[model samples]
Target: MTTCPLCGFEFDGTALSCHASCAFNERCAVICCPNCGYQMVDEQRSVVADRLRRWLARRNPPVREIGEVCALTELRPGQTGRVIEIDAENPVRSERLQVLGFVKDAEVYLLQTKPTYIVRVGFTEVSVEQSIGAGIKVLVG
Candidate 1:
């Protein structure tokens, strides 16, 4: 199933109709939204490329040891762990977390969970939305 990048509707990728006036529909790799008429380049190939790049980029994180992996929200106050992954679908959003020292291999401590998630990464305490917390996976020792 392909999701409409605009309206967040899930539908078959083969069902999208491209209304754009591009001259190369035969070679074009784009998906159009059926509901809102939004068009986006199909990123399946790019995702594969990204996966290959990540595989070659860095040494495996220290969090690779066998253990149960859970989202940041599952951590209680005073709990600590190493960030193993962030499940964000957008590169910009993932980079934003990286800027805040929430990247893989970073140590984090859960400071609070009420109203929102407050976690300490490095020397900074960051307030994060509950939904965003769900995207951050941590490896607890």
Candidate 2:
């Protein structure tokens, strides 16, 4: 199950639909926001190559991890961090992360891990995983 990026409502992964005009179909990618209607196109192979070039430009980057920090403690459980990179090879996780606001500079905190990972962003908590979490870059302040 995954949560709607805009509304924060839980849903089955199969229920998500990508925005029209998006290059990839729904099954190949994560669902768009039911509330805000946000969706991202799957990057073409050339796009992936370009992104790889950008990734290579960075020096000594941290390994990507999934999950979030404990809401109460603000410490990462076993899986949680800022999304500094993306592996477009997996479209579902990559698109899902984008939908959930896991982009750079966004703050994510892990709340719980049971049926799924409960994450906190600002005042809202939602369930997600490495598929999306790995792309986020976390910071301690």
Candidate 3:
């Protein structure tokens, strides 16, 4: 995955493939972020740097939640959860939810429960009607 340093769009990684017959082509160590077209050098590792990177990667694991299991409709205002799954059996519906950033392990918060289920995911708020909201299972304490 490539994360753009400029726009923060985490999309597929696009690497520049050199077709030119150059002596340095095999030794080129660069990665380009697909979203913003930003380029950065892929580390040409020294022994010490490699060791340090491995250690650091091990030291700081990504923040994740085991999540307290619960239903989305049951959550009151101000409740939060990591979206573990959407219970919709239809693949299209599941894909739709994923596109809306309702995939597994995404943190979500209930902003309101009246009229519709208004929830916040990341920096965006989404209003889901009861039929849809009921199928969205969340992991909240």
Query: In candidate 2, which residue ranges exceed 4 Å CA deviation?
Result: 1-81, 130-137
- Ranked by TM-score from best down, the candidates are 1, 3, 2
Candidate closer to the true structure by lDDT (higher is better), 1 or 2: 1
For each predicted model, how many residue pairs clash, with residues at least 3 apart or on different chains? 0, 11, 0
| Alpha carbon deviation, residue 17, candidate 2 (Å) | 70
What is every candidate's alpha-carbon RMSD to the true fold? 14.6, 20.3, 17.1
Cα lDDT listed for each candidate: 0.79, 0.53, 0.73
Arranged by lDDT with the best first, the candidates are 1, 3, 2
lDDT minimum window of 10 residues, candidate 1: 57-66
Model 2 per-residue lDDT tens digits across residues 1-141: 656556776655555555567676443544555556654333333466567768876632343333432222233444345544554567886677677676665666666655555777656677766454444445543
The candidate scoring highest on lDDT is 1
After superposing candidate 1 on the true structure, give the runs of residues whose Cα lies further than 4 Å from its correct spot.
Answer: 1-66
Clashes (candidate 2) = 11
Give the TM-scores of the predictions, in the order they appear.
Answer: 0.52, 0.34, 0.50
Q: How much is 27 displaced in model 2, in angstroms? A: 59
Instruction: Provide the lDDT at 73 for model 2.
Output: 27
As a whole number from 0 to 100, the lDDT of residue 111 in candidate 3 is: 93
